[model samples]
Target: MSRPRLLPWSNVDGNPCYLLGDGTGSSYLSRVADNVESVQLDMAEELLNHAADLLCDSDSDSKTTSPQLRFLAARLTEALRDVHRIACSRGARLALPDGDDDDDDDDERTDD
Candidate 1:
């Protein structure tokens, strides 16, 4: 697999870290086929399948020299996309612990 094999898009509310140094210089994206996260497990295959397609087809003009690389890339792209959709789609405001904050608060805080 090429570098950055494909990772579930991760959103960090805190400082982010990477496991640099896997022969490819960058960290290879890893995920268990059977994840404990029900959400990931539920959509893993579909997401990877879509990502695999995306990896190959992201650029219409770029001729894919390797089918294996294309498949891996597509699965990664799709997995990241799915992870993004799952982890990021909150309609703007992520309800506070009390679940009682105005939606505008989200925008205002982010703008600051």
Candidate 2:
């Protein structure tokens, strides 16, 4: 049996979703996930740009307000979550090196 793909989005109950396929990316759901991931990454880039602009504004008469900072923090947190999910899903789908599949603990080691 082929390995399941970690879907980009979770279920309505906040659980991670998976797709069992023949390891091909031609499925409709796979294409949709790919598109969603692309949009998510693009949005993250745009958010970072906006954050830089908001943080670099040095006008004394128009200081960054506490509410503005709070809102920015919330948006940043959401973006980070989405990016992290995408990274995990993609990472799980990556092909392992030869003879490297048995060393799952290698990734958990703190020392490089």
- In TM-score terms, which candidate is top? 2
lDDT of 1: 0.47
- Residue-pair clashes, model 2: 0
lDDT string for model 2 (8-66, tens) is 78899999999888788889999998999999999999999999889886773288888
Against the hidden reference, what TM-scores do the models get? 0.30, 0.84
Model 1 lDDT tens row, 6-82: 23334486332222234332323323311323456466776666555655576843755578566666766766666
- Against the true structure, candidate 2 reaches a TM-score of 0.84
Q: What TM-score quantifies how close candidate 1 is to the native fold?
A: 0.30
Q: Which stretches of candidate 1 lie over 4 Å from their true place?
A: 1-65, 90-93, 96-112
In Å, residue 102's CA in model 2 sits off its true spot by 2.6
